[model samples]
Target: MRITLERSNLLKSLNHVHRVVERRNTIPILSNVLLRADGTALAMKATDLDLEITEETPANVEQAGATTVPAHLLYDIVRKLPDGAEVFLATTPDGGTMTIASGRSKFSLQCLPEADFPDLTAGTFSHTFKLTASDLKMLIDRTQFAISTEETRYYLNGIFFHTIEAQGDLKLRAVATDGHRLARADIKAPSGSEGMPGIIIPRKTVGELQKLVDNPEATVTIEVSDAKIRLSIGSIVMTSKLIDGTFPDYQRVIPTGNDKEMRVDCQTFAQAVDRVSTISSERGRAVKLALTDGQLLLTVNNPDSGSATDELAVSYESDAMEIGFNAKYLLDITAQLSGTDAVFLLADAGSPTLIRDTAGDDALYVLMPMRV
Candidate 1:
């Protein structure tokens, strides 16, 4: 294969595909990326058996052919090249060695037969839909932080995406939880998305998809089946195997009987939590919140370190309540709020607390209280 492309173009394509290439793999071809040159474009593909990404970039093709080379090495070489430099790539007839040259620099990399690369087959999709990039970003950002990292509960290690009826309107929802805290966000479901089966999108795939939709103006096409999920943005395509497990019914975890209410400035609450957490040395970093009429007190105590206390004016008219929570969890939940005020719905000192952004009803968070 012989192709010529700009250094910027080569680097951009490499950056998109190399992240999927496993650094250490038992199979030799899995560690390499396949480069196929045809007509006016060069297609670069990388896969780790479970997930695959392919990106096509414009190139001047001297001869149409394909080859496989070390993904990381080629990415590094292209990244270090001068900007706007013309990159030349050629492979030998036997496909044993690939040469990459730019200006005064030249490097030879070992190549494997492109035939050895595995193909990821995405079976027929049962549902396909379109989503604006900004809405997709909002869905991920609001819930991804709560995804469980515990491997044993594999079902909880991803975001549960599905459609549901909310106030007579169909909405697309993303929910994630790690047992201690839960986050749920929703957006208007696009046309043809009705009756789509709920699916758990693995954490790694969610991360990769987030990278592709950084441009708010872009539109992403989504295709899903029982076993796989596919996302396409412009000339880039990503396919990932969905987690084959059922997510728990998250509705049961959200507290509905909570009657105590407190409204506080989101920024003030987050800053207070951050400051008080410094004195907490326990594993949970527990912080105590004392609420009363028109006032809220934040405190942390650690036998090994010290104690901290801060007070903020809040709009609370319910019975006085004191609750304990993980400072980090509180900060994470508060950071998700896009509004100036965060509303807290409390049942008691022992029950889970419901949090919401005053700006919208489409997002909610639930946190279990710790025994302080």
Candidate 2:
């Protein structure tokens, strides 16, 4: 394909599309990006078969053509060019090599016939709804840390996305768990998603979507079917096949009627956990929380290492309680807090503890306690 695209625009699009291309591929064309000059824009597409990303940018299309070139190599070449440099990409008729030129630098990339590239049918999207970029990022960032990496439970390797009833209203929720801990967050469901089927978005798709949602003001339109989920933003689109297993019913795990409540500064509590965790040995990753009369003491003890204790003033009036939790797990839950304080509701020492923002009930978190 022959086209002249701004260096910055080409690099920007390539940076996003190249990441979707696997570093190593058994198929030759899989390592390359499909470049098609159509109308007045240049389209760049890359895929690993499981997921695909396509981006379009404004370009001068002197002669409409298409070819496949090494994704990473093209990105690297354009990245090194001087800022504001205009990049000219041209493919010879034989389609054996593609040339890249910017100012004084020039490089030739080996090309493959676009016909050899595996084609994915861009199925007609049945449902489309818009989400603020920042909201989508929030959905992924807050819960992705809990996604299970265990190969045995492949279905738990992604965030379980579904609609749930809360306070007599339906809300879109994202939940992730690795057996030990779980994170759940919710946002008001869009108008068109009332009856949409729940889907388990794979971890990789969650990651790519995070990168694509950099603009908070940018609204992404999402379309989903039984097997596929597609996201469109501006001039970019990402599609992935959803995981096909039934996600465990998460509602049974979120405890109800936890009455004992404790409120503490989220930042201070997180820092206390960080400091005490230092004393925990590599094998035993537990931090004990002892709460009484408006005070919270975090302690970690390791025979080989040492013991640490940090006390912080909190708002708790319930009976004295002591519970143990994994330091990493505590940090993950605490990191989700976006406000000053977090309110934790505890039923007892052995039951799951519920956490939420002290200011409101927009989102809630639950953690199962460990024996100290």
Candidate 3:
């Protein structure tokens, strides 16, 4: 295989495909990236069995062939090359070693037969839809933070994606929870997505998809099946196996009767919670929120550390109530609010509190109170 490509273009594609290659692999071929050169472009593929990423970039092909090489090493070499340098890659007839040269620098890397690379088959997709990159990013940003990290409950380790009918209109919803806190966000369902099956997109796929949709103006095409999900944007294609588990009925956890309400500046509330939590103990890191007619008091007390209290004027008219919450949980939920004001609907000191952005009703958060 012999190919010539601009250093910048090769580096960009390498950065995308290399991340999918695991640093530690028991199989030799799994640690390398498969490079196929033909016609006018070079295709790069990397996978870890469960997830695979393929990218195609334009290159000058002197001799068309395919080979596999160390993904990280090639990425590092190309990254450190001088800007605008042309990268030349060629493999011997036996394909034992690959030669890489740019300007005054040259190196030889061992190559493996591309035939040994694992083949990833994307099963039949039941649904295919298109979404604006920005909208897709919003869905991920709003709920990914609440995804559980516990491997035992693998079902909760990914964002639950499905379509729901609301007010006679269909909408795409993303929900995630880690038992303590839950986040739900919705957007208008794209056409052709009707009757889409609910699927749990694994955390790793969520992260890779986020990077694939960096261009806000670009349109992302998503194809989903019972076992796999594929995301495509321009020349990049990301495919991953879905988590085979059932997600809990999240609506049951979302309270419906909570009426007591308090509205406060989102930034102000988050800052106060962050400051007072400094005095909280390392284990619990709990903070108490006392809300009265027009004032809200935030306090944290730790026996080994110290105590802190801050007061903020708020829009609360219900009877006085004090609730205990994990400081980090509050910060995570509040940080997602894009509006100026955050509205909290409370039932009692012991029940879960519901949070919403004052500007939009498309998203909501629920947090279970802690015993202070």
Please, what is the TM-score per model? 0.99, 0.96, 0.99
Q: Ten-residue segment with the worst summed lDDT in candidate 2?
A: 357-366
Tens-digit lDDT string for candidate 1 (257-341): 8888899999989999999999898585999999989999999999987789999999999889899999999999999999999
Which TM-score value belongs to model 2? 0.96
State the C-alpha lDDT per candidate: 0.94, 0.88, 0.95
Scored by Cα lDDT, where does model 2 land? 0.88
RMSD value for candidate 2: 1.4
- Predictions: Cα RMSD each: 0.8, 1.4, 0.8
Candidates 1 and 2: which is better by TM-score?
Answer: 1
Over 50-169, each residue of candidate 2 has an lDDT whose tens digit, in order, gives: 899999999999999999998998888888999999999898889899999888888998999989988667677666788888878888888899999998899999998877788889
Off by over 4 Å in 3: none
